[model samples]
Target chain A: MTIFNRLNPGNTANAAPNPQGRQTMPDNTANQATAPESKRPQAVAQPLYAAAGTGGPMTSVISKALKITGQLESTENIQVDGQIEGDVRGLSVKVGNGARVKGTVYGDEVELAGTVDGKIEAKKVVLTGTARMQGDVIHQDIRIESGAYIDGHCKPDFGKGGKASQPSLKAVAGEKTSAA
Target chain B: MPHVTHLCIIPFGVRRGLSLESETPFMFTLARTVNGKPAFARGADQDVSHLGPGLTATGLFETDGELYVYGAISGRVDAARLIIAPGGVVDGDVVAQDVRIAGRFSGRIFAPHVTIDETGNVKGRVFHTTVTVAHGARIDGRMPWRPQSYFETLKELPETYA
Candidate 1:
């Protein structure tokens, strides 16, 4: 019985009722034990995500086997190595080799080494040697590698023409378009 | 009397080791058990997907392999195995062969095997063939058991709960 209690500390309250046949004693102990166990998960859960990386926020990884069919928005960095059929918004977005995106990508910095069938809007854009972009790119700064394949216009117009008005308008318009 | 003391001390040492192992993140341990292999046995580059923190994805995610979510997702997910890490939040239906939830899940789960960790907070029906719920897990809905065939023939998720 002691071994059983040691194995399952949470079951102590349940075992008490069976052994002592005292209902009130078990109830009070159960409440006390449960109250802390419920809160402990939250505190303990934080370390798992933290341990995934060195420090700071961890970058989201969309691995190659996954396929997503909707909008992805992240405040932190995003690394895409899979397939996405909708818009993507992030601080720093990296489209890895063999990955594919069929819609617009919005980020502060965007790097592409895969295939994008739609648009890209960012403050800084880097098209690696393996990038295959088939639509327009709007960026404040752009770099296209020698082997990159681009089939559309490259416009250096990101964050231009009334910066404040453009961002709000673009955000509203982007959401409306995606919804429709 | 010395033999009795030795027996007690050994079990105490073993119990301490077990408690320490349990403190390791639930997702990592659950993944290895369900896969029946080391978590990274499959080369680190493929067959597994990770949705890291601070990501909010709203869509349908379909994968033939494993999926580990540490972020938030509000859509349908179909995978061979799904692990909701402790900080993750998923608010939609999930169809998988195996599912281990250590986070907040607010939708129905259709799986052959389902395990809810102590940190899991689940609020919808769980249709599982085999289920395990750890102590301290908060589940606010019914868990209905089904035969193994019930999951093998599940081509599409039911639109509404029966």
Candidate 2:
């Protein structure tokens, strides 16, 4: 909690004048005068999640405490520091240290520092020193660092033939082509 | 999972296993202590999960810590404290100790404490022991008040409402 307080100094400063401003407003004109002011703090009081709605770069974070037991699809980058029990589709997927994924991960660029129990299909894949991949990886380019454990085949067949025909993967490829 | 139709009684303040703090300025605080006990035994960092706006998830999400949803979720969510931030959309059942909504929620909420902010739009039943609805919040269903024990002993959600 102290960390949050320290992180949101600007919000605390904005909130300090709120109560005093409300009390000083005349009762008759309070409705009109306080309306706009009341809305400002509500917007500012939101510490971290507020920026997600204001047209910022939307990178989805699956923190360490969460466990999602289903499919996750994202158009933006995804950083997983938690446990996921299903397929994940993202633009750039980063499996952080201590994270675990139990299903397939489809992305343009996939970075692994943790463990994946299933398959990975991407154009570019990076397996860090701490990565423990227990399933096959299909990628066009891959980098496996020392100390990385891989128990399955590393197939460089991504985006070749039917593998790229999947709807989600096609959408990702289409987005990339259109963006380029 | 029992189908029992009872009157909706709004309990203002009552004793429970987990004590609810009095009205505070901040919507939530990540206190180290939970229920008067140390939250972590290993001095681990507090786990706060955030589902950003660009994500869409379908399934059950379970966490012992706080969950902030800024994305679209369709399924069940279980957390100690859940916050649906503005622009977030959730469509499913939620089981939590404390639930705060500042976004769009369309499902059943089973919690001891619930708070709906001004921008919150709720379209389903809420089962709570205590609840707060801010001005300009839109709610389209009933909020049934149950005892704190009701949530503590809830193993299965009653499917009659769905």
- Report the poorest 10 consecutive residues by lDDT, candidate 1 chain A: A163-172
Q: Which stretches of candidate 2 lie over 4 Å from their true place?
A: A1-45, A164-180, B1-46
lDDT agreement of model 1 with the native: 0.76
Please provide, for model 1 over A43-72, each residue's C-alpha lDDT reduced to its tens digit, 9 standing for 90 to 100.
755554444445576788787767788788
> lDDT tens string, model 2, B79-109?
7778999889999999877899989999899
Q: In model 1, which runs have C-alpha deviations exceeding 4 angstroms?
A: A1-54, A161-179, B1-44
Interface quality of candidate 2 as DockQ:
0.41
Candidate 1 chain B: worst-modelled 10 consecutive residues by lDDT: B1-10
User: What lDDT tens digits, residue by residue, belong to model 2 across residues A1-180?
Assistant: 455543343444534565765433334354565676587546744664566656755778787767788789888889998889888998899999989999889999999999999989999999999999999999999999999999999998888888542357446445545754
